[model samples]
Target: MEHSKIISAAMKINQLTDLNTYVIDNSGEFVFYHEDISIPAFMPGSGQEDVLNLYNQMMIQQMNQLYSYTNEWGLHYLGYSFSTNDSFAVIIGPFMYLTPDMYGLSREYNLRNNESEDLRSMCNQIQVLKTDKANSFASILQQFELLINKEAVPIRIVANKDNEKYRKRENNSIMNDDADIVTMRYKLEGNIMHAVEQGDKTTAIKLLNSNDMLFSFSERFPNQPLRRVKNLAIVLSTLLRNAVIRSDVPAIFVHRVSEKYAYEIEYSNQLSKLQQLYEGMVEEYTDLVIANTLTHYSKVTQKVIEYLISFYDKQIDKNELAELCFTHPSHLSRKFKQETNMTITGYQQMIRMNQAKHLLKNENISIEEIAWLVGYEDASYFTRVFKKETGYTPSQYRENN
Candidate 1:
């Protein structure tokens, strides 16, 4: 195969997967590099020198095979060695098999005061993949090797021996048996909450599903399976609620969701329903964080936004909102516009339209009822507003959607 063809294939793979790809000569120099996402410079042993050294190590092994490397920081990579007139290898990654442990990295790397923040920011930039997804990534590298080298090679995961040792060391560091379980459980819960707060529903749900044993209440309840499952569901609901609250989602929204789940958790008779509810809770709370979190808004603006969301079906008076936010009406309007890029009435209208659409989906509610329900007294006026906002009349939206 021509070297240019190999480079072109690697570039195509990089573009397709958004993973960094490199073609390095046998001399351990990069002949071509395609970086879609920037890898963090501060990550230990993730630099050019480290990459070249790892390639040399693979060369010394003298095997034209695909290899995986996971450094101490939990960053993963794939390498495939091949020859096209000259010896060369294609490298991909700096992806992750697990979320990076910021505290562990800070302790192990002896990061200076300012470097800890840099490490955290960098850790956020890396793609975290589950085991199956990581395996799929390995298969991508295999396909890339077949494209360039014209032969198939088995994926041999190397560089994870140290990872095993690190895990053993961590496991051995735990002092007491009961405390160890408690600590491990808290760590997993913390990870779930952090993922939820970031609106990472995939990571949060993945962590939750993968760590079911830690969350099992069966052992404690013995024969009472339904009671155990319901208790577990309630605990998970509380955790998700707190996570979204920490993300600065309005208390009203969080409370409504929490209450809805609370009712379902208690009323659910089957364990399967409870199991499904756990994922639902994570998904809804994460979506709340994504859609309703007001962390970036000023306090007054946050209050106004919350008010709009909670009372979109009722008539809104700017003076009342101004008084509620402890500011004059004009200042509140300006601040709200500056922060949200929408006037108070405009924001309220958006909320009304969203609610109107949701109600329209039910098909049981008439347009006039929905109009009254969403704060418009005149049904025709509500139809005009709904049509203007959605490019469909309420009845048309119900029929189409």
Candidate 2:
């Protein structure tokens, strides 16, 4: 069976690394158990429950994140995940104990069978091994990282040719997208950007669900399924970062979160996880924008800012915003200034300016269009307003930057 190779590799890892190795199926039942150590004396003083908990924890953690799971336990244990196409597997530790330290305690079952010479002899063979946890974890991380990156091989006994052909067709359809794919990509990207900037979490999530990003494949890596999907994630990450900046989130916050997900995408090797991470990135980045805009502002002020972010293409009036907030314009204005230390006009203008900065830097749209893009109708008047804030007219600002 295909599983023989998997079992052999797992056992060799156990022998060479001194870690307890095992493979478990999707439902977390052990499929292969190594024989390097006797069950009763496997973890020194610890029982099966404590040892098994480490594997359980590894599965639980790996199921949540896109990468391999690893953690320290009981002051001496380190657990790490490995790839196994037939099932899940984790190598549960190189115990860092340098001395006997309670790890040499005999299991009760071993003591009960001591009258039998064979059982007593096996019990007497138990030894407490010392290891460096940091070095061991690093080694495990490297080995398993390579393992998960390889194309998965199934554990089935034989190929079903018809089923294989159908699956290949399905996979190719996902990759060889045509012209309409471009339109859908643009539409979804715009929808996501608009919803996040406006704090419209509902629409953003809906759009994310409605779109299943198709990928492009070349002749060389045609069989490498995850490559294009990973590339899509990187592109989405960069676009979302730009959207975040245009929404006026702090630059440092944007960079850190963007970089974090970018690295996660780089290291990730699963389609389901990539899809999950893609949706999560859009939703969470939008949440950050909403949170950043809502800070310190009253409920009314928050509503007003949300409106500005959503409809900055149109002129805004204080009375219209106050009606939406269910408060008098004067009351809203007073609270907005008190909370944010800026007049309502000043805050809205700052948002417009941020949008203008982004468009100017990234787009070939004209200055008049840029002003109109940020809610200004009169181009000449927009220039005076831009000068008042930035000490440069829109044209001058565009030229310098």
lDDT digits (tens) for residues 73-133 of candidate 1: 5566778776656788788887865555565566567665457666766666667666687
lDDT of 2 by residue, 131-168 (tens): 35445543553353344345433221111122342234
TM for every model, in the order presented, reads: 0.43, 0.43
For candidate 2, give the lDDT of residue 31: 61
Error of 1 at 282 (Å): 19
Question: How high is the CA lDDT of each candidate model?
Answer: 0.75, 0.59
Of candidate 1, the 10-residue stretch with the lowest lDDT total is 165-174
| TM-score of model number 1 | 0.43
Q: Report the lDDT of model 1 for residue 146.
A: 64
